[model samples]
Target: MINACLLNDDDTLKLVSVAAGSTLPTNTIWLDVNQPDDEERQWLEKLLIEDVPDEDEMDDIESSSRFRVGPDGVHILSLFPQRLANDTRGVNMSFTMRKNLLLSFREDDVSIVRLLRYYIRHGKANIRSALDILLSLQDLKVDQLSDMIEDAYSTLDETADTIIEEGHVEENLEELVRQEELNGQILQALYDSRRALRFIKKTFESSLDDRQNRNIDEMLNDIESILPHTQFLANKINFQLEATMGYTNHKQNKIIKIFSVAAVVFMPPTWIASLYGMNFKFMPELDWRFGYPLSICMMILSAGATYLFFRKKGWL
Candidate 1:
């Protein structure tokens, strides 16, 4: 769907829905194309006087494909965090800026866009230019990432406590790996945003005012702060993983030790039985009635001796 928001003469924002045949309002300042149909895409292309990239093009990771500067203006393809039912991740989004207009295309909704809308509707933002809106979106995206990191910190704390206090990670290897993967995703998203911001800062070096530059600098600082946080979480996860492996090794060793001690305890009995079973017609003990009783006594004594030896050596 195509959703357009126009800034009015009275400094208020008005939202408009642009359908297949609907005309784009002349005062439109921001146009959001969400999972646009072919007709809507064509309309946007015509309105913006530039070709709208397809989903595949938007997903490109190369610097050249991600950002471009032209006589008209700058085009940026960025990845923003999207929360899934079970996980949070980054999704590619396309933004085109020309003069006072900013157009965004995404296959799905993102919190950045939602937050932007909330600010505009509540008159809490003074969005004077397309770049202003972009900066505001970036600010909100950073906040979202920070919140995710805070949650990860809490989880890692709990995981560490479980291992220290309860003496177990209480999760299989797969579960631990999944958490690591999630942390990696959050780290990647932060990196992508940082790259995008730096590119923007460099591209329009002279156009930005002191306030805009400070805002961008503040954003960079925020991302810098978050980067270390993710690194800390990663280290903690690795520690937990190692702790899990150590516990597994301990348990396995205990089982092996039990079997080894059992074998040692049984050795003497097996040896006495084997010695008596030897078929020898000339053996006097074979005919003796007390032979079996004597053999049993020898086996008991040998077994007890072995057990005591192991206990003294602390190998029991």
Candidate 2:
């Protein structure tokens, strides 16, 4: 859907829905395009007098392709993590800023954009220009990212608690690994947000006035502060993974020790039986019934002696 938010003379926001083949109002200051159809896209392109990036262009990762400043405006494409009911994934969003107009393009609906619109309509935000709107959006994004990191920290704490209270990790190894993977994902997302904030600061630092520059600076600082917390959580998760692996190896070694001791205890009996079973007609002991009983007794005595030696040495 295409939405045009127009700033009125009374310092209020008026939103208009731009449908296919409909005329875009000339008074629009902010144009938001969400999953635009071909016709809608064409209409927006014609209205802006500049090219609008499609999904593929927005998804490009190259710095040159993602960020560019032309005579028309400054275009920036960034990735932001989107969280639904129980799932989280990244979304590509494109922004274009001209003299007094701002255009944002997204293939999926973003709650941030919706909240911005709601605040503007309800007179809760003191938005005067497209720049103010952009700053507001950035502030909202920073707040959300902070919340995400906080939630991840809480989850890590809970996992750590589970490990401590259980006193063992054998049954929950898989769960621990899964949680570690999740923390890794959250860390990456946090870094992505940090990069976006830095890019925005660099792009506008020279062009914006003092007030806007300070706002951007503050946003950058907020992001920088949160980075360490995410990194700490990632490290803690990795430590948990290593601890779990160590416990598993300990159990395996204990089993191997038992098998080794059993093999050593039976070795003597096997040697004695093998020597007596070697038959030769010249062997006088083989001809006597008493020799057979004596050989059996010797084999039992050897095995018992080996067992006693092992126990004495604490190998058992």
Candidate 3:
């Protein structure tokens, strides 16, 4: 969007095309323009008596634009986490000239457009006013980080403080599930924190002044302070998840042991029957009248020996 702020005061408001913005009765004019048509750009071009900076030219504005044109100590092009790029909670981009005018062009940044409109409406679109607005935005961003982590810390702390153990089996499992949820939330918050830091870092990289740099550092510090706590919470979640897995494995092993024992207990009987079933004509044992009874006894003895062996080996 394109926003115009005329920062010419009554005493210094002199209209002489384009010169240095050293003095003037600043008249602030702010507008919100999105996808500015050719006609709109022409209008802006006429009003400013200067060419409008296109999005392409303004992509890495700090890199392309001169120090004089860029915001003091603040780079015009700052990278945000990819997540923020999709965020719709946009802020207004402000435009301010030294009591002269501010012409802002943002075809992709919606929040900046909103901010421009809000500040202009509130009589806060002058060059000084615009700087104030931007500072407030930085502050707001910092505040956002603080609030998000603060709430997170409190919730995690509460969970850590209390343990609900006496309930139905499902309840116990549900608690584990809840812990998983908490961890997920914490990870999300961490992602957000990182995103904000990236954005701040991008802003600082282009900054040409100390004030803006300080702002970026402040934001980074905020993220850093919470990192340890967030990391711990994440670790706690992982530990819990691992412990739950161990219990599940133990239960499975016990079940497998029971099945194995049953198989072993019947294996000896199976061997004895298979041996007798080999009814060859030259089999003396089979020809004897007591052979069948002897085979049965032999099978019982084999079964007993196998069982004892298994018991002694602690296979069960």
Q: Which candidate, 1 or 3, has the higher lDDT?
A: 1
**TM-score quality measure for candidate 2:** 0.80
Q: What is the total number of backbone clashes in candidate 2?
A: 0
* TM-score, predicted candidate 1 vs. hidden true structure: 0.92
Q: Name the regions of candidate 2 deviating beyond 4 angstroms.
A: 14-16, 84-87, 115-126, 161-211, 282-308
What is the model-wide C-alpha lDDT for candidate 1? 0.82
Compose the digit string of candidate 2's lDDT tens values, residues 168-263. 575456655655555565566556566666776787776678777778788878878877876787788788777767766777798999888778
Clashes of 1: 0
Of the candidates numbered 1 and 2, which has the greater lDDT value?
A: 1
Candidate 1 C-alpha lDDT tens digits along 57-91? 88898888888886547889888888876577777
- Per-residue lDDT tens digits for candidate 3, residues 1-316, read 3334444544221222322222322354323345677876766655553466566654433424422333322223322111142121222232323221334445555443355446555665433434434444445544554554465456545544443332332443455465455445544444444553455455436542576566656766766776676567667656654555565677779899888877787787888889789867788887799999988888788778878888899775
Alpha-carbon RMSD of each model: 2.2, 3.6, 9.5
Please give the lDDT score at residue 316 for candidate 3.
Answer: 59
Q: Candidate 3: TM-score?
A: 0.46
| Top lDDT model | 1
Clashes of each: 0, 0, 34
